[model samples]
Target: MRISRRLRPRSLRTRLVLIATVLATSAVLVCQAAGLTVMRSWLTDQIDERLTDFRPPSPVYRDVADGNGLDHRARTDDVLPSDYRVFFYGANGRLLSESLGRSDGEPRLPHTAAALKLWNGRPTTVPAETGDGSWRVVADSGSDGMRAVVALPLDTVEGATSKLLWFSLAIGTVVAAAVMVLGSVAVRLGLRPLNRVEDTARRITHGELALSVTETSPDTEVGRLGIAFNTMLDQLRAALHRKDAFERRLRRFMADAGHELRTPLTSIQGFSELLLQQPAMAPLQRNEAHELIARNADRMSRLVDDLLMLAQIGDTPAIRRELVDLLSLAADGVTATALRHPDRDIRLVPLADEDTTPGELDVVEALGDPHQLAQVIGNLLANACTHTPSDTRIEVRVGTVRTGPRAGGTDRAGRTSAAGPMTPGIPASVIEVADDGPGLAADDAHQVFERFYRACHTGAVEAQPGSGLGLAIASTIAEAHGGRLELDTGTGEGCTFRLLVPETTAPKGHTR
Candidate 1:
């Protein structure tokens, strides 16, 4: 008990050691105590039997002996050897005769209850002790009023008992010691995984979320605890990781905003300084300064507008029970994309004009802000143009889709329109804008969509032209419109960008 309390401050090793010691000690104590009980019973039995046989002959023996002179040596001659003793007396309790031979010099009689009972009763035995240590004595009385008593020296009896006790103590001590050692080792082995969990928990505060238990022995309480603890750690690590990523993204957004504004502010300051320093400069120089100032100011205005749109994307709710023309939206995207990148070639790919082109275009429209949809289209077109070489061709494809086999399954991607995010049988449309530029690398295709990431290896990315906010803004807009943006690596050729939007079946207030 004390050992357990003291172990609290030590390592796992100490606590395990304490547990092992207790179990081993208890096991050995029980075994030893049981052994002692059995031995005591066996020793007592032997002593009782020895005393019974050594008792002197009663009247029946004297009758059988007739004239042979009934003394202890002669009475026991046919039954016991000379190392035993016998004493005889009358029923009146008067001393008769006593005989002893080869008795190891210990007292023949201890004057115990066996002697007194022999003088009174017919037969009995009792424990006796003497100067030599201890003994077992017996007494017998007969109808003829003759009594017999027997006595055995206690030196040998005590010697055997002493040896037995020592043997038991020695064996129990050895076994208990061995168990303590072996049990300590086993306990430590079983608990090593728990120690690892402790260390992992401590490491968590240091920002290492990767620590986790690998494997452990099962079927025990400790093992279950380890499993549960590991599962909790996993959840905590995931939440912490998201929190860290969110904080990092927020800081990066602030820094990018400041940097973008600095360029326009610096230009405005320079133009104002020029005006102040030389108010009468030449017309050419004056015109150049005014152009520079206006361009920088316009850039700043565009930046602020995009930032505010991003802010409102999620908060502004769209009524889903409304309809708009999907194809018209595609046309508007082409014109807007052209205006953004006037130096690039942006074209709309016309599909086979079935009756569905017009009818489906109406149904393919989704319940969302058409202005926001146009913003998404504009962002995608701008992103593609930024990563495409001058004069590179861009194709914008738009059409309606069906879920069932009648309209042919979902698409080549193995995902049917039935499983599409816009709800099955709801006649949605997809805007596929692909560019034939040096396509993005296979590894970077997915990561390039991350906020502020530029495809450095694509060789066509605008490394410094604009804020890296176009793709993120486009993605946000797509999500707000109940749609998703999917990208293809286009390693074999140019990049493929697809926007899938759900169709609404209700009415629409006029939208552009």
Candidate 2:
């Protein structure tokens, strides 16, 4: 719920920005301090040097030589302002001469007896006031008892320093603020890739695997992370697809298996009902009930056998490049179906495409497992029959069906097709079992392959019959052999199931 929270906690941009801000602020502080220290020290050194270097004439002679305040003895005025106190002191406790400009009652120099005494013996610094409100005084010993005394103002110098300090502080503050702002921007920019990755990852969860691959690369660590994440998404998508298929098949298998087993149970119940209804009836009535029960039992047994065969076929491998005989598979399927459902018509016609026997005897051939193919055809036929009333037409015709037109994968012979089409250029070696029975519901086209998905609304079943897994099993088998099972929704009246098997150019081989 916290929208302001960071998506990438340890982001590169944030770290770099923080580091830059710290260094920038530190540099500003150091430079400002150094500048202020150097300026203050240099000013202090000049003032002290001036105090030490000044030499004055004798008090009487200095006053007489300069002619009151206009003399060159006031040369210190040219260097500093007249507001400062410039005077001469004797080591013999004599106040030689003083240039007291604008001092009415008392001189700006500290002329108190205690200060003068200290000033005479020791060249000292003291509190003094000149034309300005107040200043500090420095008196230095000179040779021949002519000491120089200079009064420097605390107020003026401090005012200048205070202004300088303020400016420096302002500049430093601005610099620090700028550093922080720029750091934040740079952090966002640098972490932009990570944001992209986050967004792409979010999209991938919504079934957009193609959204994230370009966000990061495998070159840098971040790129590597991106690649790994994308790969994981791909694997997850595949897994989910397989899981859905599995659930669908599982449900169909359970439904069909359960439905197929119902006959025996119903027959058992029916026989029990009859026996109860006619306990003292004729012996013929009992015999007829027994016969009906046996017939139902036989039907149930065959259904179980078919279910088991289909399940077994699903488990077997159907290699794409392996050889198989279409004729033999079709013949066997036809014979089994004819025997199993004697009341219904089942036929298999090996309709060769070219019609002429090329390279001896031209028979339908392809790459597949014979057992799975048998199951595929048998299940298709059985499905057609199950949906139709008895005596409905059901035929499976196999031949060299064409597959092309759409471009696709590279074959060893350099042939390609498009769209990964099952029925590509021409009619693929297809076997279609269609009937005039109640066709598929428009909605059931997609769901017929789903497990246990009986069309309860259609009223097709006396009860839910036929494990829905049959078509699913057949479809899987077909795909394993580079073939596909397609349902032709021929209106809602009937659905035609087509098995498109890829026929190879391999020479005709003898079938045992």
Candidate 3:
């Protein structure tokens, strides 16, 4: 086991080459063994046939011999080859005459009458009593009470078989070598792409995030693996980028929050210090200082509240979801804004073909946190009123719009919006707060929904003071409700803020 483990290939290419070599060698060996067996059998049969061709002369020729008994040596001249041996016996099982072949070593033939009779003249293999080797022998009895045996040695067959075996070994060795070399080349070429992938991984490990696998063919296993590996790398890179961006945003948000809070805190502290240091000041002066302090404190409180609302909206399950009447929400927002800024002409534009009668509740509905939705609408209206002039006309249009099949749209900045398209043929509730006022510049409009983003130009004479978090809060709330707040504005072209949310139906047996 230890030896085998040590011998096992460590590399894939080596293993593949070794396997191919082993298979090729085994096949060659099997063929060689089978062929050797067949050839050996054929050679042995040829020797046996030659042994059977020996026809001994009858004993009648022995009486006319020059009294040399049976002239057994003459039998080799006509029918027997130099390698054949002949043995003779009398009817009484007595040894008579024996004749040796031309070969130097003498053959061990059957000496007893019973042994000779057992042969029955059929060709067969028998071990030589001389301990030299084996032979193919035939024995038979003649009509004149004479018994004769013929034999031949098997040295030629064995010599030829040995040479053939050596040849087969040489052939098998060459074939195995060829297979190993070619198989190694093929395996190396096949694994080149994987090597590149490994190199890519190494580079990536060292912080090269942009590197990707180049072999992306879908037809081969290696190609498919490369493609999947590239996909995973892409996802990893994207996730890392998102993490970095989030960290940047978080740092900016922290800085902005600290700056926003510091202004009000400083004002409050300065005013309180003034009042405490000058207790003898006039009543009117004292009252004004107290009011300034209270106003800054209130501003700080509102900022904190907006921050908390953003945090809550970020938590997916924290927002309550219920049926909401968008048109009513828009109408209420318009009414409230008009009261706040009577100079600005604010009005809610009803959906086309819809009744505008007083107390009419039928309108486009959506599923969301009604309170949050109301806050979103109120924020939009307040933003419009704050940014626009007194004479600017603010129109709140509430209705349902048909959406496309594929759900996705980019914001003004080409960033993915908080909401995607609704189901095909389905309608989404929309509220557009459009104002004929000084609109924002293109650059400012892109980041208008960002936290603490204050536009310097409203196309109006002057931009109003704001915490700059209202629209950000509104956008977050819209996202929590699976909706989006979109802005369309240009310099001097007026500004339009559209709120789109998926439409929903009320539960059965439920009434608004």
Candidate 1 stretches greater than 4 Å from native: 1-40, 50-55, 59-132, 144-155, 171-259, 276-295, 308-362, 365-371, 381-396, 400-429, 434-468, 479-483, 487-496, 501-512
Per-residue CA lDDT of model 2 for 169-270, tens digit only, reads 888788878987977987787677778888877887787655646755666766887888878878987898999988986786676667667757888798
- Clashing residue pairs, backbone N/CA/C < 3 A, model 1: 410-416
Please give the lDDT score for candidate 1. 0.63
* lDDT of each residue in 306-392, candidate 3, tens digit only: 898788778763357777777777778878877877677787764333334433334677888888888888998888777677688
Instruction: Identify the runs in model 3 with alpha carbons over 4 angstroms from their true place.
Output: 1-7, 51-78, 85-133, 136-151, 178-197, 219-222, 269-290, 353-362, 404-425, 459-464, 506-512
Question: What lDDT score is found at residue 317 in candidate 3?
Answer: 34
Ten residues in a row with the worst lDDT in model 3?
405-414
Clashes of 3: 2
Clashing pairs in 3: 407-421, 438-458
- The candidate maximizing TM-score is 3
